[model samples]
Target: MKGRATGGLIVALLTLMLAACTVVDLDADGKPIMPKDPNAKPGYSNQTPQQIAESGWASRVQQPAEQQALSWADMETKSHTVKAGASESVFVRAGGVVTAFDNSNARERHLTMTINGKPVQVQIGPVLRSNAIRDAAGFRFDEFTNQVQYAQLTKALNRHAVKQLPAVDASWVGKPVQALLAVTMAPGKVDDVVAIQLQQGSP
Candidate 1:
């Protein structure tokens, strides 16, 4: 019986050796190995979770405030010096607290104005207004005060009107008109206003 048992053990050992020697395409545990899933989403084996979230949010957020708006108004006005041969250059302190230094001709009026303490300048190009108002105490007066501010402000307004106006209107393009630039300096506020009239000459 011992010889029979020894024979049985030898058979079992031989079977195991044969299994190990076999070149089947199986894993170390002798289970069939499968191919990787092609549709599986890729993962970062390198980056931690926190780094991914922060990087994503940073890209979507707005930039800092300095790059956002146009330059500060008060700081912007100080840079410009009045140009040569302005049609009128007399300093007129008029209508309570409004100050006007105007240079004008038949073609246009360029104005330098200081209202309250703010400075603005403007060129009244050949555009006609049926009836324009220039006030002593208002935002419009501020536009007349500073040349740079008034030019920028009027350019914006005129551009808006030009866009809406009909293209075929020839009179709207190059018609000479009366232009008035005024400055108002009130308590705690400075302003300039430019008034244009088409029917009359420069004002």
Candidate 2:
């Protein structure tokens, strides 16, 4: 009887251990990993990243950018704040002089564009780090299930945005250029607009 009781306790403990493991998903560094299956997740499509990107992302980003665009002079003066979930950003449609280029690294590519005597660093990517244009549109976070869906949308937007850039190089320095930009709020970050969409030539 005592032997049967001991075996039962061990079985119960094992069952609980298995249940705990099934409920928790940990990454390599022991942090909780967010689930990435879009189909299993409500409100997101089962489509692959490329397929998902093929429709509507451009219009969604473009509408907000065109409507909210501010001139460099006006942007410097206003207290603009665009909400995206808990975060905020802004948009600019202005002309600036190309001060310099940082395209040597390739992955961290960008250029310095001076607006009203202040240097604003604009991303001209063969690789883009942030999805500022998309994020500036204020899409809700809970609308997507996981980082996979979120990042795929970003990748698509970046691809389309990059295609709009002027054919630039070291030659572009000291020339006037105009673009629509998405950037984090603040004049300090007016110098750091990631992921730009452009209007090339004499501005």
The per-prediction CA RMSD against the true structure, in angstroms, equals 22.8, 11.2
Per-candidate TM equals 0.18, 0.66
Q: Where in model 2 is the C-alpha error above 4 Å?
A: 1-43, 77-87, 186-191
Per-residue accuracy of model 1 over 1-203 as CA lDDT, tens digit each: 99999999999999999988745488889897766579855432333333322342223111211122122243234223323322111112221122342434534444333333444443343342211111211123232435544334333433332233222222322332222222232332333333321122222
Per-residue lDDT of 197 in model 2: 70
TM accuracy, model 2 = 0.66
lDDT tens digits, residue span 39-61, model 2: 75345555655554455555666
Q: What lDDT would candidate 2 get against the real structure? A: 0.70
Clashes of each: 27, 1
Error of 1 at 114 (Å): 0.9
